[model samples]
Target: MKTEAVRLYGKKDLRLEEFELPPIKEDEILAKVICDSICMSSYKAATQGTDHKRIPDDVAENPIIIGHEFAGELVEVGAKWAGEFKVGDKFSIQPALNYADGPVGILSAPGYSYQYIGGDATYVIIPKEVMELGCLLPYKGEGFYPASLSEPLSCVIGAMHANYHTTPGSYVHKMEIVDGGKMAILAGVGPMGLAAINYALNREDRKPSLLVVTDIDQGRLDRAASLYSVDFAKSKGIDLRYVNTGAMDNVAADLKAITDGYGYDDVFVFAPVVPIIEQADEILAFDGCLNFFAGPGDSNFKAPLNFYKVHYEFTHLVGTSGGNMDDMKEALEMMSKGLDPAGLVTHIGGLDAVIDTTLRLPEIPGGKKLIYNHIRMPLTPISEFEEKGKTNPLFTELHEICQLHNGLWNLEAENLILEKWNKLT
Candidate 1:
């Protein structure tokens, strides 16, 4: 079968081309992609091309499709999965595949790199390795966009789930946040940061008694505060504060004042900036855990850490690139119960504009950029829906749907979007 996709040949070289896909093997499955969200990592792969750790060495010679966050419907299920997964079954993928048992096994390779097809294409074949690793998950969500978003949400969940311990003479490591402990999200208010905020507030396992979200951008900080209000946190019996550090004369001192000069129990750094990272380290409580959640494209990106704090106060740092299948499952379960991370989505477009969108993702201001593969529409910001509705009736309907859900994207909005522009077979 022939399909169109965005293929990466070399650094800063992305080609939108049509190619023929081989027949699915007996153990493989063929899926038709419905929604693919452009991620910052996709932009990194596009700019780095073959030099990227995830891109296979021979990608320049054999160009590969680039995308990982996507959702689709099964078009052809192999004999092995015929009964278990039939045609028309909707699904999402945990793209971090670990086929080999060794340390260096397929950690860099995901759904959208060399040897494996990605969701940028109209259809992709599910490799035997992916099925064997159980990375392909059956999605029962109302829409494909939400299923596609689960991958990013899982990364946020993984960061929160990461455990750390203190070495107080004994080798035993303590797990979870200290009960009713204080937490802070440094340089938060971005899409993933907002997800972390939601997970920190809503997770039943380790709920923070006090949560503070800090950002330099007042606009972003205000949006986060409006979405997750201090009043709402008070109702939940938790103290929540949104602060713009840029406005403060002494940011670190102000943050410490919130915790009564004791510092935060857990701190999450959402930006790759070294200054921000250092600031996160500066505001740690004794035996505090810092999670470097952002994935930087530069391999040599270095940040200074206080070894003194690590040895004396037991302050430690950890980083996670992506989540496992279990994290994805947990995110799906939470979303099913109306956690509504869909508010993280701020922009939407169609496959026709995906190539350009992927190339310019980092520069684009806003949250998730959802792309409908079968649809042919321009990139539309959610904030412009009401204005666009004046000229286009379709956008007017979308505006109405969003209004019903408190001006946020919901299943109704997704269904309305697909109902207007789903031309797939």
Candidate 2:
């Protein structure tokens, strides 16, 4: 089979190429990728190339695929797993494959270490290890975009699950955020931060009674409030508040004042900035668990913490990078049960736009940049669909469809774009 994909050759060296894929072995499966959501991790991999731990040292000789957050359909099933999975099964992959003999040992993942199995390709050969490790997940969601986005939602789900609280003088730690307790997300309103907000509001198992999302950008906070409305959050029995910390003189003090100086039980830091970390630390209640959700680019990143609180007050800290298989399954299950993650996607593009979009992801001002693998369109923001509709018929229909759903991307819009652009390919 022949596949088109964006491959990383070296530092900031990415190429869009069409190459012949080897025949799938009996233990392997053939898949046709539908869509991939561009992640900052892919941008880091593209820029750092071999320097990234998940990237192989021999990328110059053997380039790897450049996407991970993706979902697709099965075209052919290998004989070794015909009974377990059949052709035409919609699926999403949990990319964190902790296999010992992979290209990068336990750090190996689908989008980073593999040559023919990344999410950027139109077609891919799923290796036996993916099946053996059970990372191949069957997604019964309505559209491909939600399944692709489940990977990111799983990350926040894992972060929430990883948070813990403690009892007085007890050595054991209680898992998950404190239910019906006060919570805060510092520097929230970005793409991942929005995902955290969505999950925190809609979670059926456990949730915070008081949810406060903070951001320096008023525009972003306003956008988040519009998408996940205060009325909607109140309907779910949550007191949701969007606060712009840029306008405050003392962010920690202002946040604590919201809880009547009782402080917060669970605080999540969404930005890598030092002040945000310190602000999160300063506003913790007793037995508060501060989850550092952001990953810093610098290796020597440091932030000040109150050792006095850590010792006497039992303040806790934890960090999470990505989700495991159970977390991905939970995300997919939630989406199937009508948890919409459309709020995170801000732009849409096609296979032809993957190279530039992946390389300049950080420079782009938006949420997820969703890429349809079989199309040939440039990266265009959904917010501009109405403006672009003046000259383009495709954008006209897209604008009309988006208007029906409050200007957010939906399954109808996704299907229309695929139908319109797939013919061009």
Candidate 3:
């Protein structure tokens, strides 16, 4: 089979090319990739190339495809796994393969390590290890974008589950954030931060009594509030507040004042900035758990922590990069129950746009840049659909459909794109 994909050749080198895919082995499966959500990690991989741990050292000889947050339909099921998986089934992959013998060993993932498989391709051969490790997940969601987005949602789900507290004078740690406790997410108006806020509000098992989301951009904070409304959060029994720390005289003092000087029980740092990490540390209550959710591109990234609190006030810290299989399943389950992640996506593009989008992801503004693998459209923001509609019929229909759903992408918009653009395949 022939597939079109964006392949990484070396540092800052990405090429969108059409190539022939080898036949799937009996232990492998053939699939059609429909859509993928661009991630910052992909940008990092494309920038670092062979220097990336998940990318093979010989990537210059055999390039790997780029993208991981993807969902698609099964096209051909290998005989070895026909009973468990069948053709025509919709699926999403938990790309953190964690396999010992994968292309790049334990850190090997679909988007960063494999040659014929990745989210940016029209077709792919799923390796046997993916199924054996239970990373090939069946997604029964309405649209492929939600399934693709589940990977990112699982990350936040894992972070929330990873937070823990302790009882005095014991080695045993209680898992999960404090139920009905004060929580804060510093620099939390970005894409991943938005996911964290959504998960925290919609989670059924436990919830914070007060949820404070802080960011430096007032416009982004306002947009976040509009998407995840304070009224809706109140209905879910959460006191949601959006704060622009950029406008404050003292960031830490103003944030702590929100909780009546008691500080917060769970604090999540969403930005790699040193001040934001320290701000997260400052606003922690007794026995507070600080989750450093952002991964810095710099190896030398460091932030000051209150050792006095660590020894006397029982403050602690933990960091997470990706979600486990269980977290992916939980994200899928939440979507099945109608937890919409559309708020995270801000732009849409296609296969032709993958190379430039992946290389310049950090420079682009807005949220997730969702890609339809079979299309040939440019990367266009959802907020600009109406403006672009003046000269294009496709954008006109897209703008009308998005307007019906509060200017967010939905199943109708997805169906329109697939129906109209699949001819480009």
lDDT tens digits by residue: candidate 1, 1-425: 77778788888788877788899999999889988888888998888876676776677777877789889999998899787888999889888886564122565455446444686778888877777878889887577777888888999888877756665887777765665888899888999998888877788776889999999999999888878889988877789999888978878788989899999888899999997888888889899999899988778999999999998999988898778889999887777676777768998887777788888888889998888877777888888999988888788888888888777887888887877655421
Tell me the TM-score of model 1.
0.94
State how far residue 184 of model 1 sits from its true place (Å): 0.6
Model 2 TM-score is: 0.99
Worst 10 residues of 3 by lDDT: 416-425
Query: Which tens-of-lDDT digit does each residue in 212-239 have in candidate 2?
Result: 9999888999999999999999998999
Model 3: residues >4 Å from true position, as ranges? 422-425
Local lDDT at 238 for model 3: 97
Candidate with more favorable, higher TM-score: 1 or 2: 2
What local lDDT score does residue 217 receive in model 2, on the 0 to 100 scale? 84
lDDT of each: 0.82, 0.93, 0.94
Q: Over 4 Å off in model 1, which ranges?
A: 101-105, 422-425
Worst lDDT run of 10 residues, candidate 1, spans 101-110
Q: How close is each model in CA RMSD to the real structure?
A: 2.3, 0.9, 1.1
lDDT of model number 2:
0.93
Q: For residues 224-302, write the lDDT of model 3, one tens digit per residue.
A: 9999999999999999999988878889999999999999999998889998888888999999999999999998888
Error of 2 at 407 (Å): 0.3
TM-scores, one per candidate: 0.94, 0.99, 0.99
Which residue pairs of candidate 1 clash?
none
